[model samples]
Target: MIRFGVDRLVADPDLLGGAKRVGLVTNDAARMAADPARLARVALREAGVPITRLFGPEHGLNVQSADGVHVDDGIDTMTGLPIISLYGERYCPSPAVMRDLDVVLFDIPNVGARFYTYTWTLYHMMAACTAALVPIIVLDRPNPLGGDLSLAEGPVLDLAVRSFVGEDAIPIRHQLTNGELATLWQREQFAGVRLDVLSCDGWTRAMQWPDLQLPWVPTSPAMPSFESAQLYPGTCLFEATNLSVGRGTDIPFQQIGAPWLDVPAVLSDLARRVPKGVEFSEVTFVTGLAPYAGELCHGIKITVTSASALRPVALGLLLMAAVASTHRLRFQ
Candidate 1:
């Protein structure tokens, strides 16, 4: 079982050893166990740790965005604590941001895909903290999808394509816990950072977040549940193409279609091309934001009833091909 750093900190108060002040880089999704009422803040607060500040990544503490939406710095109305937006004007923490904290705790729920910007945010923060001589405490969580050593997917991002979306050459489905990635990164990517990882006790690399008995909160606007995270590494490629990734629907990444798509035909083609753990169903959607907004687009919903039998990245590639061949899908 992987020991979650947050669980470790809770179990052993001596880990902090009466450190008076602390800061946390987190979002609304950073909760303890399956309860939304019990968040990382409450866990730390109950343990008598004073979390002086709160830091939010891309989607803000509330995880509200239409993609590329930047969160602004403000006071958290709920926590009454000052909230800083690291995903604001800059992608990384400024030296000024790291100057006051003794130890900055990181405890964000990640989707386990390399292209997700949060991992890069963590890397850059770790690098900044390393430069400023502040220790980093990572309270780890399970990757929503099991961290099994599956065949990698997505393009190994070339340096030129390195935006916030694709930070490094890590595979699309990296299949590593955030803590493990942090450790590997500390040794090779940012060795100077004073990194301390508290792992999850009940978790294993083979266990996904849904198996961990934790509640699934949308880590970002589009990824609303464990199902979305499972399909995201692949379906997210829709962002590169001129397709509506179901932004307006209750189910975002799970439903993919465009006005130009022939839903039934595409589903049949996809079934013939690559059908395994997932199956496609005809569906129609109107995106509130992005690509085909307000226009009804026909497409298929890729459902993964059984996760262990699914290969998200491979399926994603197949879907990409199917869309490209059938409809003149353009990559942005």
Candidate 2:
């Protein structure tokens, strides 16, 4: 069984070395190995580590908010600790919030895709910690998509298009764990920042989440499964276009469609350019929130048959070309 960084921290509290009050930047997805139900904050508190303040990233601490919606800062009723929102007006914590903290701990789960916002939240947290002169202890988690460098795909973030989504110059499908990413960021960007990474035990670059025998936790509201994470790096590109990436549907990144699309023609075109490791089936859904909310959308469902054989970034580009060729596709 692979032991998570949280488990390691619980076993050895001395890693922080007498740091009493600590601030944690985490969400519900951050969990310890022993109990899947226990979040990082609760687990840390049970283990005698004082979590004085809580920090929420894009979706808030409980992950109840929708994508791209600004989360408001509030007190965690369960813990009575003040919860700061990083996705709101302030992307980073103010000096007042950082002043009382001896150390900052980060343990959010990332989908291994560059477009996802959690890693960027990490980047912001690192910057804040650097400015405050507070040490950051990153409880590193595994990249659900596996960490094979050879599988990494990119258009490598054209710094001009840098947003909250693509903050760094890393490839679209960056095959590195959060700790490895933090280390790389520290080396390339902030050399003076005090950063400590507690790596997962028994995790290798070749092992995906399925190989670890762990339960699938929703990293975000849309990303509910390992399969979703696999398809995300590719399907997420639809967000930049006029197509609906099935955001309001149960299977968000697993399907893509629009009310304006011609299903038969789109399916036929996609079949001709079918990428390896995946199968597409015609699917229709009506979203209640994002994109085409009340209107029915016609699209295809992506079934990832072989994860190892898939090249999501390349496949995404190919998909875009197919859609554009067959329909009046518009980039937003």
Candidate 3:
């Protein structure tokens, strides 16, 4: 069993360097893999780390808000720490907020995809900390998609298309963990800020999520299963389209659907082009939430048959092409 950064911090509190005022950036989903019950803040505090404030990236601290929804700043009734909303009114903490903290610890996990916003929050925080001369520590975890650098796919961020999701020019499936990302930026960009990465022990570059032997926590409401995450780097692209990426369904991102979908035509088209390590099966369901909520929809369920053989970014493009060829698709 690999000891994650949080577990290490709990075992050895001295790693914090005796910072008087420490800020923790995390959410409910980022709990310790070993304990699961105690969150990083609670665990760190119990271990004698002076965590003074909290920062929430997208989806809010408790993950109460839906994806892409803006969350407001609030206080944690559990910890009584002032929770600053980085996904809303601001993308980074203000200079005043930075002044109140001696160091900031980012403990969020990435979904092995570049489009997720937590990594970008780190990007923003790195800039803020660099300017304020505050040290930032990233508690690293294994990239859920594994660390096989050869498996990385791209359409590396074109500066023109960079948003909160694609903040840098890395691949859509950039095979780097949060700490590694921070390290890269420190070397290439934010060198002035003191950065430390509490890495996952014994985790190798070739190891995927299943190898971690860690419980799969849903970092976002939509991401409920490992299969969903395997499909995320590809299926999430549907979010920008008229089709529902199972957002309102139990199997979010594991399937794709739109009320107008011609299931037979889609199936026929994909029959010849199914990518390796993934299989498509016809599915019809109602998404009780958005897009065509409550309406019966038709589409294909994506299954990751072999994680090692799948290229999600390429798979995403293939899916888009197949669906678009079958129907007149619209982008959102």
Candidate 4:
């Protein structure tokens, strides 16, 4: 069985060493086990862990907020804890917020892409904790995309374009668990911070989500499925352009379209230039929100034939290039 970090921690409370006031950074996606729909906060609380405060990342505590929308601090209805918004006015917790906490624990789910904001949130938390002289414990999770080093891809990051989306110079598909990322950042950037990573049991670099037999929880509003996440390392670049990457739709990131696209031509070009492991079919959509909301978009639906063979970054580039050749594509 694939045991997540949260599972291991709750199973062995001694690992936390009776910390009286603990602060947790988590979201709805951070579940403790396969049943009972218990979040990490609830699991810890039920296990007699004293959780003093809750920290929410980009999508607030519930993971329901829209993309790029700021999440505000509020009380968690179930835990009744003061929830601080890390993606709101500040990307990191203030010293005041960390004052009463013995240790800060991070247990957010990541989609294995470097540009995903959760990893950046982890970075900010590490930096803040270092300044406050508090130790940090990261309850690691699987990368969703298997952790094969050979699959690592990058344009790294050009610090000039660094935003919440892309914070460090890591590959686009970083293929490392969140705990490993915490360790990397500590060694390379925040060396002074004391960090402990509670790793997943029975998980290896070759194990994907399906291999773990875990339920698919939406990491963000747009990332709704395992297939979508598998394609996200590439499709996410569409956010920089005027294209609709199926946001506000049931199948976000699985389809790409814009009203101006010449569907037939785009599909033909994609067939000729795009890599194997994916099949495309022309589709028309009317997005209810994001990018081209209320407008008709004509594009292609991407279906992965083989997850291991898919090179999403390369496919994204080729798809963009193909669409640009047939239509007047614009980047916002």
Could you tally the backbone clashes for each prediction?
A: 10, 0, 0, 0
Candidate 2 C-alpha lDDT tens digits along 1-332: 78889889988888888999999999888887777888878878878888999999998999888888999999987678899999998989999999899999999999999988999999999999989899999998899989999999987898998999888899999999989999999999878789999999998989988998889989889988888888899989888788888887789888888887777776787778868898888888999866788889888888888889999887787788778888854534
Runs in model 3 with CA error above 4 Å? 329-332
TM-scores vs. true structure, each candidate: 0.93, 0.96, 0.96, 0.97
- lDDT string, candidate 3, 1-332, tens digits: 68789889889988988889999999988778678777878888888999888999999999778888999999988788899999999998899999978899999878889888988999999999999999999998888998889999967889897889888899888899999999999999998999999999888999998887777888888888777888899888888788888886789888988778887887788778867888888899897787888999887898888888999888888888888887764533
Write one digit per residue (lDDT tens) for candidate 1, span 13-84: 778756667888888778766345577776777777778888889888888855677889888776788888
Give stretches of model 2 more than 4 Å off.
329-332
Residue pairs in candidate 4 whose N, alpha carbon or C atoms collide under 3 angstroms: none
Q: lDDT of model 3 at residue 139?
A: 90
Could you tell me which residue pairs clash in candidate 2? none
Which of the predicted structures, 1 or 4, would earn the higher TM-score when compared with the native? 4
Off by over 4 Å in 1: 1-3, 34-36, 329-332
Comparing 1 with 2 on lDDT, the higher-scoring candidate is 2
Model 2 global lDDT (CA atoms, 0 to 1): 0.88
lDDT for residue 186 in candidate 2, whole number 0-100: 93
Against the true structure, candidate 3 reaches a TM-score of 0.96
Q: lDDT at 328 for candidate 2?
A: 59
Q: What is the lDDT of residue 89 in candidate 4?
A: 98
